[model samples]
Target: MSSNSPSSPLRVLVVIASSRPGRLAPAVAEWFVETTRRETERERMVVDVVDLGALALPFLDELEHPSTGVYAHEHTRAWSRRVADADAFVVVTPEYNYGMPAVLKNALDYLYEEWAWKPVAFVSYGNTSAGTRSVQMTKQVVTTLRMMPIGATVALRIGDSIEDGRVSERPMLGRAARQVVVELARVARALRPLHLAPATDGTTPGPVDGLSLSRVGEGDDVSELLVLQRSCWVEEAHANDTLDLAPLHETLADVQAWAKTWTVWAVRRHGRLVGAVRARAVGSTWEIGRLMVAPDQAGNGIGSWLLAVAEQHAPEEATTVALFTGKRSRRNIALYERAGFHLTAAPTTPDDAVLLTKSVAATTLA
Candidate 1:
């Protein structure tokens, strides 16, 4: 999110909220982006435009609601990714019978957490109301989804601000557009910490910000964990020169069964499952398995922190903690080594993998 750095260029997604033929939303959105270009560049902001008309999203067709984020269709997934990638948003719209457009509402209803902890601004054009009513109606819905709507807005009078179906090049509106971008950037940076999970009563703070760790439960967490496993082990499959990694092929049922037996912990960022590791005590040794981190989050020290969490929860009677990885997974090996684990003679280990262990007494397992 926010281009890998909280202080990096702000990603502002401008949404064109009208889908009707010859709609003015595109022209309005174009004007907003162009007018704000100078301030955005000066403030290290990046602007991207999304046209609801071109996107052609149907009325909330997914069986599961946006709250679950279990997107069943490709369109929903694509939309979710785009929204999640942005740190802020701007909507350009026209009044629809004194409310927001149906297309805009539909697009907003397609995802949930992706909209959380971000700032949004609006530019509205209409007859008597100048689309201010539409903006008010949208703010209610966006607020319920956890988006922060700024005070800075641009409301256009179609009768005065339009010439030839486009916004007239007016200095007043250009200045207003700049204000919207500036206000959005300020609010977004202020709200950035809300996206991060600081220390909680029972949970230890992670290495980086925005991490929440918890035991795996019977919910969408299992489904998401199953997905994370398949994704994180692609490198393991490649390194071992085989597609035979269990994590790469484990089904939902397999994961569910294991959760019933092992103490499985997961790491979530903004409600997305980003990393996980599971372990169980076996004959004086705590056997840790299935260490995983989302590909984009692999280098963020999440895997190491998750390992520490597993160790911290290990049975006190266990003498050592152990895990296994593909022998060629040098990255994983190196991480374990730095954590004070080392390879040992594991006669039961599979041919393509090696067992690694660290004495529980030597670790901070409290």
Candidate 2:
């Protein structure tokens, strides 16, 4: 699937917020999705229907705060991924006692950063108020998550607009539903910058929002980094025809020990550690290694951007930056060369690995 960035196709998650048996939420969501299908495809928008009834998520059960992004259960992580993958949202809901459904609120409370910087639209149904109060209540919670709630909405009074548990196929209603998607796409594009976490030094923003960069430490960062390294090096392992790679074989303790001496940095996107790199001065040359980006996010210039960031952390006494990869790793070599590193002779490199180096001045000037 393509990313939900400004330059990529937009992914709209249609959330059916009611789990009650025989509820009309699914019908409402179906109407919204079908109405927008043709126009959405033409405009590079993908609508995914997610029904709370089918998902069957229980009440929130995690131990840590949602803001921490440390999920103890697979369900929470799965939920995080779905939310993180979306660029916008459209909720199909019914007002209950003049407010949003409790299940909807629980789902919203389960994850923090995933919902940040996205736009949410509403398709509501109820009696007298046409579920407008539910939307009003949801808007308040979504705003607190840094989500943008657009002005376009569809409110349906069951007595007037619904038939046999399904929304009536009215042309005006169809137009309104399509308009909701149109508005969501525009707002998502405008709010893309909020996805970027500003640099800690306040010099520049991150490549995407919710980026938290810091020295590697305890509390899941090391374990997450370890997992990322193994995941990212599979391609390298295949390219080199070897399973002896340290990145794949290294233990958690190995990573922890190295972090104590190396100037290690981890980049978390929306509380998930998606990239990392480590560097330390080896005499006059800065030995930078273990640079990795999530495979799904590769080819987006994150690796290159992260490599440059690692260089900036080099000690003042360092005159060169050096790294290594398997000899047959063409893609890695090409990326390095583009970043101004050249393959160099080094007998000290591992049996199947090759070294590359660049003068600090050239790298800095570039």
**Whose lDDT is greatest here?**
1
In candidate 2, what are the lDDT values of residues 1-366, reduced to their tens digit? Answer: 114223667778999999888799988888788888887887688788898878877899988687655566668767876776677899998999999999999999998767877899999999999999999999999999878899999999999999887889998899898888788888877765455222242223454545666777554488888889999989889989988888999999998888888888777777777888898988999998988999887644456557767876667888999999888886677557645677899878887989999998875544
Return the lDDT, model 2, position 191. 68
Q: How accurate is candidate 2 locally (lDDT)?
A: 0.79
Q: List the residue pairs that clash in candidate 2.
A: 195-209, 196-208, 196-209
Candidate 2 ranges with C-alpha deviation above 4 Å: 1-5, 196-366
TM-score (all chains, Cα) for each model? 0.60, 0.59
What is candidate 1's lDDT per residue for 1-366, written digit by digit as tens? 233335567778999999999899898888888888889998788888999999998788988666645556668767876786688999998999989999999999987766887889999999999999999999999999888999999999999999998899999999999999889989987876544322221354554566677887755489998888898888788878899878878899998989888888888887788988888999999999898989988655577567766766667798898999888887687556645677898789899888998898766411
TM-score of 1: 0.60
* Candidate 2 residue 269 C-alpha distance from true site, Å: 16
Which ten contiguous residues of candidate 1 have the minimum total lDDT? 193-202
